[model samples]
Target: MIENIPLLVTNISYGVTFIITVGFGLAVYLKSSRKTAHIMFLFLSLAIGIFQICHVFGINVVDGESSRSIFTGSLSVIFVICFTIHWVLAVLEKDSEKIKTIVGFYTVAVGLVVFYLINPSAFLLNSVPKLYLPNYYEAGNYYWLMFVFFTVGALYAFYTLAHAYRIADPAHKNKLRYFMAAIAIGFPLGSTAFFLALNINIDPIYSTLFSIYIIPLAYGTLRYDVMDIKVVTKKAVSYALIIAGIGFFIAGINWADTLIQSVYTWVPIWAIPLTSSILAVFIGGFVWEKMRDIDILKYEFVTVVTHKFRTPLTRIKWASEMLKKLIPVESADQSRLAVDEIDNANGLLVELTDMLVSLRQVDDINYLYSFEESDMCKIVEKAARNMNKHILDKKIDFSLVCADNIPSVMLDARRMQFALQIVIENAVIYTPEEGRVSVSVTQENGKVVVSIIDTGIGISKEDIDHIFTKFFRSKEAKTTDTEGMGIGLFMAHQIIERHDGDMSVSSDGIGHGSMFKIEVPKA
Candidate 1:
């Protein structure tokens, strides 16, 4: 049991890492944003956490296979199976948008539960006893089946993460790359421990080695924000190597203990010191990286801060220049000109402030808002007129048609305008030169409906649900000359919801035109 220290440490570390990862996944889920990748991510984290906890604490952790353990461990089977299916869904699913990775994962989850529920046989527990080892804690013969399933599940989970890590964009590439690398290293190590536990090797030392993997996992997650993965993996590798070094030290202590076990019941139990030394060695290197080379965080921080200052600075300059020219002719009406010029600068300032606020709020997925009353017709016209230059440049025959009986609605004017702009801009982006883009408004069932109908490359049904997702662009969107950030529609969706409105998109399939319908409650 003493020899199991390193493995226990590794397992505990993995368990901690798993907890944080799952928490992050849930955070994204609660934000009214849903995506296959994120949902799969949540399940994967949840399952990994569960497995790590089981390994670290063992099934009899609380009271050695007590009824509580059975219940908890049994419940974990569902999560494990779901994690596996999360991968299978990704592997088999051709449609990127219509996938329900979570709900789909749960299907396998149910199967796992039902099988165990019907048969609480040896696969789950050999004997429900108060103590975990030496007497009541022999693994059931059918435990191999569970091991088989778990192995398959872990493989699929890792596979999905691996694929995601490879294709993620630069903004997130490094974090994901390291996170996946951590998973890659730990999963294999974990597998080795699993096989060893199953009589492949009856050594307690394997458990210690397995437990130590958690340090790397935790380091990857904490040091690099691997959950929100960005590019830059040097720190992650450093973290892993630290874990490796610490692992060796722990191994040394285990060796020392075994030597003493040959002579005495125990030695000073020096593994903790060795573990700390390993951590210190790696962490020392981490500190050195910041001093010796460029840090990505430094660059990101500067970039974000500079953008804040630069945009407003440009706006202020433009406003000043415009005022300067006008003042040369209109300076005689001093007070009036002064007020107008100040208002111009103020308006730009207000716009900049609002942009920054929205940027921050948008990061919160669950952001909701208060609604105000405004004219739908005016809103559509305003958005179109605002982007008139873009319309002309694109050669899009943009038009706004409103039914004579169309009514005003209760909504946030600024938000509605933003939504309208996104939809229109998206239409313009998707539409080819000379292609027509029509914005039509109508009153239907006590609602004001604004539709942006484009005669451009249409979205397929499979891709429609994903259009409103953050950072989700269709293959078509990627191929076009359109330089899109893919957040326009997502932002629009949030804004519409804040206004007590609803937005939906439809496309027949590939090459068919798409329509974005936004409906807000009539005032």
Candidate 2:
């Protein structure tokens, strides 16, 4: 039994690694099976899983049979590299014909390596028990060539990822960062096994720790929009933890029975099943809670969408009826009035559509942004100009002041304009007619700041905290603007955040007016 300790430990490590990689791969594939990148990710995971499982058997089998298992595990490395390169290219949106050609050439090289691997004599000399490992193999004449192939493939994949990260937009850059981090941690550590294969005396403990990569990979998946999956909630994380805990608990009991049968004899066998049943109950409750939360979110989303779209749709229908009545007989003024009403209704529909699109994009990993150095003053002026009609219609006392020689900031101009327009338009809409509305641009503390102050129905203290939440309307806002869908501010906030900027609002209370400030770092 004491002699079996190393084999047991090694099996446990490889077994856990196999489960994690395959589990993540399946999750991603189930979420989006059609995506090329996701498919490649699954293949990579399977390759790793195969490599780990092969090692588990290779280390436990008799020395005479170990050579085949180790050789198969070594062969899996080629697939790992192939899948990694394809996955990286797909994720980075570099899947062009030229890239395919390059990948094909790499595949040819991998094929040659496989040809060499098929004849065990070419890649493996023999297997012998070594320091900690149950079976460690010595390298043959061509083993160095396999290592070179693996090294070159890894370097190329890393290079591709790094180069793409440098040029990727903010959102894509964030996703790539997670992938790069995982590679940085896992690949090099796992490569330590190769040193042992070459007859070096180095311990292969780092190879067992390769599973540590899942930490960052899992975190990136849950915390960010990765592989087109939205951010998972804490409840989801709790569910995963509970499941993993149960698995570990059961495995622990079995391992204890095997390793310490004399001590485990006192423990009742029924106790294990009872504890597992309790855990199952806990999981069920947790899953129910998550389901309830999802249901509530869906209901709220539908309510907002339907409530917001109904008004413009009704108006459009009414205008069409009026247009039909005014056909071919009335004065030009009447016909023009109907056409204008239809046009206004259409404009409202377009605005609503744009808002919905922005809402959808806010949490998307693939949202594209084009950043360039831009003038804060010009962007502010443009937004104000766009809201000119609203200002005139409300007859609000509007003023604009811009500081000269303001430093340019790097931002997506169109998105910045949209964000500013939302604030200015809200100021115009919420403030009573003849109330004051002011826009100003200045630089402060290495950042360009845009401020919009208005004598509007000011935000109450209770509502201020939730102002940027999607579909959340303050009591005063609901009373003042029944048509508001409560998405503009949320969209604006997301845009500013993506630009490495922040937005803040201050209000004295419900009738004291409010001020909104946006700050972006200077280019």
**CA-lDDT, candidates in order:** 0.59, 0.73
Scored by lDDT, the top model is 2
Q: Model 1: which ten-residue window has the lowest total lDDT?
A: 224-233
**TM-scores, all models, native as reference:** 0.47, 0.52
Per-residue lDDT tens digits for candidate 2, residues 315-422, read 786877777676754566556555655655465455556556555455446766789998989989987886666677788999999998899999889778888988
Model 1 / residue 510 / CA error / Å: 7.7
Candidate 1 lDDT: 0.59
The C-alpha local distance difference test score for the whole of candidate 2 amounts to 0.73
Runs in model 2 lying further than 4 Å from the true structure = 66-73, 97-101, 167-173, 214-223, 226-523
lDDT accuracy of residue 100 in candidate 1: 62
